[model samples]
Target: MTLKTEPFVLNMGPVHPSTHGVFRMRVVLDGEVVTDMEPVFGYLHRGIEKLAEERTYGGIIPLTDRLDYIAAMSNNFGYVLSVEKLAGIKVPERAEYIRVIMAELQRIASYLIIIGAFLNECGAYFTPFVYMFREREKIIDLFEMVSGQRLTYNYMRVGGVSQDLPEEFLPALDKFLAQMPVCIDEYDRLLKENEILLARSKGVGILSKETAINGSVTGPALRGSGVKWDIRRADPYSIYDRFEFDIPTGSAGDCYDRYRVRVEEMRQSLRIIKQAREQMPAGPVRTKVPHLVRPPVGETYAHIETPKGELGFYLVSDTSISPYRIHIRAPSLINLTVLRELIIGWKIADLFVIFGSIDLTMGEVDR
Candidate 1:
């Protein structure tokens, strides 16, 4: 006699730890295998775009901080770049180098979170997670020296950074740059060739290159699928054209490839920061502008290679202090478009690894 099986739906989260942040997944399962999945968003939405319309251009920087709280510096960079373009503001040379250094440091810090969380989801538990955070804390200390905030640093301003790096900031950053590569190497020695990690992640949840580009995935996720596209390299912004760094790509497009790409990218971030440090000159950090910026009636969009992915802000001005309309092309939400394609037919346990590989923060997704 043959037994009959029926598919059942399991709700993964709106509050579970593995969902990253208040995200939900309705999974159609056949026993332990996921047959279909629907990602549920909005649990964390705070109408950030709508709120931007009510705040002045300068005031909106804090709101962007809450979008991708893990990489708040990148959020600030993207928004300020958009506002500067809208107002035709020119940033100083020193400020541009400072921006590059901060942005690159933010990229490294954000990738640490992703790598740690991904390894944790793969069942390495807190060992790797804590190790990653140890380095991240050093980066955070450097940010605090400049921004005076541990998280949600509202550091980037409309013209440039809120202020020049403090007297001690560069020295702290130089120390970090010197020691970070050794730490990265230590992480590699510990887990890069672990048998268990290889078994769990390699050759799992592959996303094709064509699908990634068509879905508009960016950053490491797109690069993980063997696409050699990076906003910093593809379309230089600020003084990114002045720096030399390599874009890392993965061939298999699997969980392991994504993890490897992030690790390699961290090294590249260090390279960029080192160059910025060597090239940075002394000048005024912020350009003088009206207390309340009222751009000419026009619209502009600016995108940056945020740690999670490509974060773009589109602003429309009606010659007002506040934005006439604000729209965010949040990578967290866009990258989720490929979830169903990646998770279906995999075991429920594999779902976490695949999802974590994308490195999304629900704040950006639901915002």
Candidate 2:
């Protein structure tokens, strides 16, 4: 005779390891399987949008640094581009190249954290995390050499970067570019085919292509769902059109495919950086803009492909030093919309593995 069981709810996080940050998951479990789920967020909200209205256009850059703090440079890129569009500011050629370089570097760095953290959630101990962080440290060192900040670079500004690359920066970057591919391969060799990781991740928590697009997911998560939409390729921000890179996609849209998409994206990011370094021209890194940047009363939207997804900034300027209104089309928030659908039928233990594959940053979600 079969025993009857009622659904039981399990609340994980708002302060759990696999939530990544202050995020909560309300799960209804029928024994070991998840029958329904609700993603709870806003535990780390800082009112960044409300705060942007109170600050000058230039002052808003630093605040953007906090959103998706892992890919802070990409946050800077989106906000600055929106401001530049509103103000009719033109970025210098060299600054465009520098912005691409910094953004791509941030992409690889952020992916490192994603891959490492996902493996840890999959119960790989800390081995993969340690290996990825070793390479990530080199990229961070290169960023610090130019911007003098390790985590929040605040390096991009409207119409260009805050400053030019130091003379030594390029050579050091050249060294990093030379070594990153080998390190990536080493990660693949170490854990990509481990039976346990594959058992936990492969064919698990599959997100459909239609659901991903309709849900407004972007970046690797969307790409992992077999969608070929990358803002860099789709919208052509900055000099992205000038550079050539492949949009990597996955077949199954499962946790393993998401992992593969990010890993392949790191390789593609390296390719873009290499070509940018070879083709970059020498010129002023910034264009002059007044301290009080009063854009003509207008509205504009700008977005870039961050590690997590499409990060966009929409601005309404009223011919003042501060924006009349600002809205962030945060990828982290939008990507979580399908969380319940993805995990509803999966086992309870697979929940964190699937969540980690989505790779969210709570700062952006709560912003």
Candidate 3:
């Protein structure tokens, strides 16, 4: 005699530890395997675009900080660059270098959380998370030294940065730069070869090159799929063209490959920062601009490589102090598009592993 079984429905989040934030995945499971998934979001939505329409051009900078809260500096850079391009404002050369420095530092801090969170989801306990958090504090200290805020740094401005780098910030940054490589090497030795981690993550949730590009997945997720497309390399913005760094790509396009891509990216970010520091010149951090900035009647779009992916800001101006329409090309939301395709054949236990590997922040996904 034989018994018949039916698929059961399970809710993964909306408020679960591994979901990362108010994200929910309605998964249909046949025993332990996930057969189908419906991703449900909007729990954390704040209507940021509508708010941007109401705020002054300068006032919207702080609003951007809330998008990818983990990497607010990148959000600031994208929005300010869009506004500057629309208004024809020229940033000071020194300010450009400072911007690059801050952006790279933010990148490192964001990746520490991402990799740490991924390992945590893999059931490695708190060891890796705590270690990465310790290093992240040093970078946060650097940001505080310059921006006066730890998480939501509203330091970027229309024509330049809010202020110049302080006297002590450089020496602190130098110390961090000197120590970061050793920490990275230690982390690699600790986790990369663990037999358990390998068994769980290797070749799981594979996203092909064709799928990644067609789905518009960018940043480390796209790079992990063997597509060497980086916004900084493909489309140079600010002083990125002047600096030297390599775009890291993965061949397997699996969960492990995504993890490896982020690790290599941190190294590349450090390289760019070192070059920017050496080439940094002395000058004012900002150019003079009116309190109420009204750009010409036009539309503009600008994007930056944030920790999650390519974050873009699009604006329509009517020659007013506020934008006529504003839209954000949020990578978190776009990357989620491919989730169903990747998780279909994996087991329920592998669900969170694959999800964490994507490195999404719900704030941006629901924004």
RMSD of candidates 1 onward, in order: 0.9, 1.3, 0.9
Question: Per-residue lDDT for 338-367 in model 3, tens only?
Answer: 999999989998998999999899999988
> What is the model-wide C-alpha lDDT for candidate 2?
0.91
For model 2, how does the per-residue alpha-carbon lDDT over 28-81 read when each residue is reduced to its tens digit? 998898999988889999999999999999999999999999998899999999
Q: Judge candidate 3 against the unseen true structure and give its global Cα lDDT, from 0 to 1.
A: 0.93
* Tens digits of per-residue lDDT for model 1, 1-367: 9988777989999889988899999999998999999988899989999989999999999999999999999999999999999999999888888888888899999999999999999999999999999999999999998999999899999887887788998788888989999999999999999999999999999999999989998989899999999999888888888777889999999999999999999999999899889987888999998889999999999999999888999999999899999999999999999989999989988999999999899999999
Positional deviation of residue 307's Cα in model 2 after best superposition, in angstroms: 1.0
Error of 1 at 130 (Å): 0.4
The candidate 1 region of ten consecutive residues with least summed lDDT is 158-167
Ranking by lDDT: 3, 1, 2
- In candidate 3, position 91 carries an lDDT of 96
Candidate 1, 101: how far from true, in Å? 0.5
Q: Answer with 1 or 2, whichever has the higher lDDT.
A: 1
Model 3 ranges off by over 4 Å: 1-3
